[model samples]
Each structure stands twice: as C-alpha cells, then as structure tokens.
Target: MKKLVLTGAAGRLGSYLREPLSQMCDRLVSTDWTEDIGKLYPSETYVKADLGDLEAMEAVLDGADMVVHFGAIGDEAAWDKILHSNIIGAYNVWEAAARKGLRRVVYASSIHAVGMYPKTQRIDTEVPHRPDTYYGLAKCFAEDLGSLYWDKKGIESVHLRILSAAQVNNPRALGSWLSYDDLIHLVQQAITTPITGFCVIYGVSNNDRVTVDNHKAAFLGYRPKDNAEQCAEEVLAAADPADPHDPGQMCQGGPFASVEIGFSGTASMNIVQDKKEI
Candidate 1:
C-alpha cells in the first residue's frame, strides 16, 4: 500500500501502532485532534484533524490506500459527545473512504456493543448487537455502517470488537485482556487479509477462559500469540470477591453490563498506563 491513514494517532494504542503501520505503507498519515504526538517514525507524518469534520477527514484520506479509524471519545459520556465523535465520526470515515475508493477500513469497535449477554453464553461474530450503554450503541452503529458500505459500495472493512486492550490487573481481565502484542498482530491481519468485506473478529488474547468465539472469522488468519492466563493467579488474588448474581460480574462485558447509559464502565477496571513512547 502506498499510504495508510490512522486516526487517533496521539492515543495510547495509536502510539504503539504508529511505528508498525508506518513500516507497512510508504507514507503513514497519522491524525488526531492533538497538535503533536511528541515524536514521529521515519514514514510517519502527523496531521491534526477532527473526526467531526467530513471535509477535513476526506482531505486527510485523499491518497490513502486504507484507514485504521480509532479516533473517538474513548469513554462513556453524554449522548451529544458520543453522537459527534463516535456516530457521526464513523459515518464520515465510511463516506470518505467510499469517495476516495480506499481498499478497506479497520475499525476499533468494542465488546460493549454486546454487553448485555451473559458470560456463560459464549458469543460469536454473528451475534446481534445488544448494547449496554450509549457508547456501546455508537459501536453497534459503526459496525452496521461498515456492513452497509460493504454491501452497497463494495468498500471492505474489518471491525474488531475489542474486549479489553489493557493491562490485566483484575479477574475480569483474565478472560477479556487483549495484550499489546496480540493487538498489533490483529491489526496486521486486518490490513493484510486478501478479502475482508465486512468481517468481524474478537480483539482478545488466546486466553483459556475467553467468553467470545472467533471460529467464524478464521478466514482472516488472526492467530493471537499472547494469553492473559499468565497473570490469572495474581489478578484473581487482587480482585474483590465477585457476586455471581451481579450483572457486572456475570456478564461477558464485565463492568459495562452494570453501568447506566452514558456512564463510564472502563473506569472500574484498574488498567495500567502503557509504557510505550507517544
């Protein structure tokens, strides 16, 4: 690919992706609302653009072969904030990609989109959306938008419903954690896959206790290397006694299942900061 555009380039996950993504394409256009990302890799070029601005987003994606869209509120918030950054932002990316004739869009969707399901009931990519919060609703919208674009415009997309892409510091994370190495692997597969016309895959490690199934997305060739079970003992020891009846503890979505609409659920997880340079 000649060029690759990455939104949310100043974020924690984006920081780790920049160097790898830059090496894959001749020119890596990294964008975020932030003015700077501290430093840049050889093929990286920073561009500050808001996801809410369709014209500005189009300008940034003009010459890109593919787009890895990660820009958004990245939190549970008021409906207005989510509507702008997550909902409208998703539409803009898809529209811009279609107009530009990009190869594909790699999206950062979340497990919260199906948070209402019980932990015992393992879900696959084919499961219907069961959003738990407004933030989750936005993810469902984006996933559906990806589907619509692929069916109507022939634009390819790979939506990764990330469970928990953070440090494993609690019991819930033992089953849901998506390690940094695995995340890089998943993104690489999403980009290199030959034909991904609206594919959905679980963004999780190869944990023994995993609640989500990725068998249907085997064609994408996303074989994760890391496992959260390595930290299981420590995490379980640190966790408070879990109530099996509590939705937060019994649901596959963890804290997200118990949170009210527009409230923060990720705040409950004790995720450690990434040590990677941004």
Candidate 2:
C-alpha cells in the first residue's frame, strides 16, 4: 500500500503497531492528540490531530489507503467524554474514510461491547451488543457504524473485539488475554485480507481457557501463538478467591461490568503499564 494511517499512536497497543505497520506501507501516518510520540520507525511520521475534529481527520487521512483506528478514551468514563472521544471519534473516522475513499478500516473494538454476557456462555462475534458502560456503548456504536458504511457506502471495515491486550496479571486474563505478538498478527491479518466486506473478530490468543469462539472469523486466518495459560499457575496462586455473584468476576467485561457508568474498570485490574517503544 502507498500509505496507511494509524490513530492513537501514543497508546500502548498503537506503540507496538507502529514499527510493524511501517514495514507494510510506503508511508505510515500515525496520529494522536499528543504533541509527539517520541521517536519514529522507518517510513513512519507523526501527526497531532484530535479524533473529534472531522476536518482534521479528513486532512490526516487524505491519500491514505487504510486506517487502523485505535484512537479513543480507552476506559469507562463520563457520558460527555465517551460521546466526544469514542462515539463521535468513530463517526469521524468512518465518515472521513468514506469521504477520502479509503479501502478499509481496522478498528479496535472491545469485549466491553458484549461485556454483559456471562463468561460461562462462549459467545461469538454475532452476539447482540450488551455494552457494560459508556465506553462499551461507544464501541457498539463504532461496530454498527462500520456495518452501516459497508452496507450503504461500500466501505470495508474489520472490528476486532479485543478482549484484553494487557499483561496477564489477573485470572480473567488467563482466558481473555491477547498478547502483543498476537495483537500484531491479528491486525496484520485484518489489513492484508483480500475481500473483507464488514467483519467482526475476537482479539484473543490461543488460550486453553478462552471464553469466546472465533470460528466465524476463521476466514481472517488469525492464528494467535501466545497463551495466557502459561502464566496460569503463578497468576492463580497469587489470585484471591473470586465471588460467583459479582459481575466483575462472572461477566465477560470483568471490572467494567460491575463498576458504575463513569468509573474506571481498569483501576482494579493492576495492568502493568508496559508499552513497547521504538
């Protein structure tokens, strides 16, 4: 491809994607609201832009072939913040993609979109939305937006309903973790796939205890290598007893499912802030 745009360049996951994505295109335009994302990889450049600014997004996406949209307020937050960053930001990405005539959008959707479902039920990508918070609701909106654009405007999109892409510190991560290497592989598949009209796939590794089924997305050929179960003995040994009745423990969304609307679910997870840097 001639050019690819990546939003949220400064984010933990986006940081990992920068170096790899740069190799796949002649030019990689990485955007975020941050002043700078420090160093850049070969063929990579940074752009300071807000996701809420449609005009700015249009400018950043100009001449780009595809966009990997990782931009958004990551955790549960106030309705106004979620509306501006996640919901409106998603619209700007799709709307700008449509206006720019981009080939496809590889979005970073979340399990929170279907977070209300019990972990016992191994749901698939087709399961109806049961968002756990304002953040999750925004993800649902983006997934639907992607579908609408595909059906009506002939735009292509791939919504990767990422479970948990952080450190395997907690027990839930044993089943829900998506290792960084697996995440890169998933995004690569989403980008290089030939004829994906509008797809939704779970972003999870080949965990023995995986809670979701990805058989429907077998077409994407995303074979995740890492398994969080490797750290299971250690994680489990250190873990406290889980309450069966707590939504945080029983539901797919974990903390988000149990927390109040505006609160942060990630606070309780003790996720290590380890971001890959180039």
Candidate 3:
C-alpha cells in the first residue's frame, strides 16, 4: 500500500505500532489529538486530528489504503465522553473509511462487549453482545456499525475483541494477557489478509488459562507466540482470587464488570504500569 492511516498515534499502543506500520507502507500518517507523539518513525507523518470531526477524519484518511482505529476513551468514563469518543468517533471512522474507499478498518473492540458473560463459558465471536458499561456499549455499537457498512457497502472490517493488552501483573492477566508483540501480529493479520468481509477475533495470547477462543479467525495467520504463563507465578502470588459473587472476578469483563457504570474499574486492580516500549 502507498499510504496507510493510523488514529490514536499518541497512545501507548499506537506508539508501539507506528514503526512497524511505517515499515509496511510508503507513507504512514499517524494522527492524534496531540500535536506530536514525542518522536517520529522514518516513514511516518504526524497529524493533529479529532475523530469526532468527520471532515478532519476524511482529510487524514484521504488516499489511505487501510485504517487502524484505536482512537477512543480507553476506560470506563462518563456517558458524554463515551458518546463522543467511542460512539461518534466510531461512526466517523467507519463512514470516513467507507467514503474514502479504504480497504478495511482494523478496530480495537473490547472483551467488555461481552464482559457480562461468565468466565467459564469459553465464548467465541458468535456470542451475543452483553456490554458491561457505557464503554462496552460503545464497542458494541462500533462492532454493529462495522457489520452494517460491510453489508450495505463493500467496506470490510475486522473487530478485535481485545481481552487485556497491558503488562501482566494480576491473576486476570494470567488468562487474558496479550503481549504487545501479539497485538501487532493481530493487526498485521487483520490488514494483510486477502479477503475478510466482517470478522470478529479475540485479542488474546497463547495463555495457558485462556477462556476465549480464536479458532474461527485462524485463517488470518495470526499465531501468537508469546504466552502470559512466563509471569504467571509472580502475578498470581501477588493477587488474591476474585470473589465468586463479584462480577469483576467471575465475568469475562473482570474489573469492568464489577465497577459502577461511570467509575474507573481498572483503578482498583493491581495492573502493573510496565508500558512496553517499541
């Protein structure tokens, strides 16, 4: 591809993806609400754009081949923020990608979209939506929007229902941890695949205790080599098992399920601040 556009370029996850994506195309346009992302990769250009502004998004995505959209509120927040960033931002991305004639949208969906489901269920992409918070509901909306555009128009989409892509320092990480390497591999697969109409794949690693299945998305050639088991002993030893009655523990959404709708669920967890650098 001659050009590719990536939103949320200032974020921790987007920061890591910039270089690798830069290597894949002639020009990698990385955009964020911020003026800069500290530094730039060799084949990258920075753009300060807001996802809520449909015209701004269309301008940035002009002449792009594919879009990797990780631009949104990363956690549970007030309804207004969720509505603007997650909901409206999503609509802007899909509509812009379709109107701009981009090949596909590699979206960052969340396990919270089905977070209310029991952890023991071992659900797959085929399950129904059960969002635990306003944030999760926004993901649900984006997933549905992706499907609608693919069905009505020809724009393709790949919704990655990410479990947890942070450093592994808690028990839930033992089952849901997705290393940065695996996250990159997942996105590479989502964009490079020859044909993908509208797919849903769990964003997880080869964790030994994983409860979600990615077998349906195997054709994408995403074979995660990293596992969270390496840090299992340390993580489990530092944290106590979740209470059976607590949705934060028993449900797939983990901390997200147990928190108040507008409150921060991850604030109480023992997640390590070990942001992996590229």
Clashing residue pairs in candidate 2 are none
Of 1 and 3, the candidate ranking higher by lDDT: 1
Per-residue CA lDDT of model 1 for 172-203, tens digit only, reads: 88889898899999999999999988989999
lDDT of each: 0.91, 0.96, 0.90
Better of 2 and 3 by lDDT: 2
Q: Which residue pairs in candidate 3 have backbone atoms (N, alpha carbon, C) closer than 3 angstroms, thus clashing?
A: none
Off by over 4 Å in 1: none
Q: Per-prediction TM-score, please?
A: 0.98, 0.99, 0.97
Best by TM-score: 2
**Which residue pairs of candidate 1 clash?**
none
Better of 1 and 2 by lDDT: 2
RMSD of each: 0.9, 0.6, 1.2
- Looking at model 2, residue 37 earns an lDDT score of 94
Report the C-alpha lDDT of model 3 over 71-152, residue by residue, as the tens digit: 9998999999999989999999999998899989999999999999999999989899999999999999999999999999
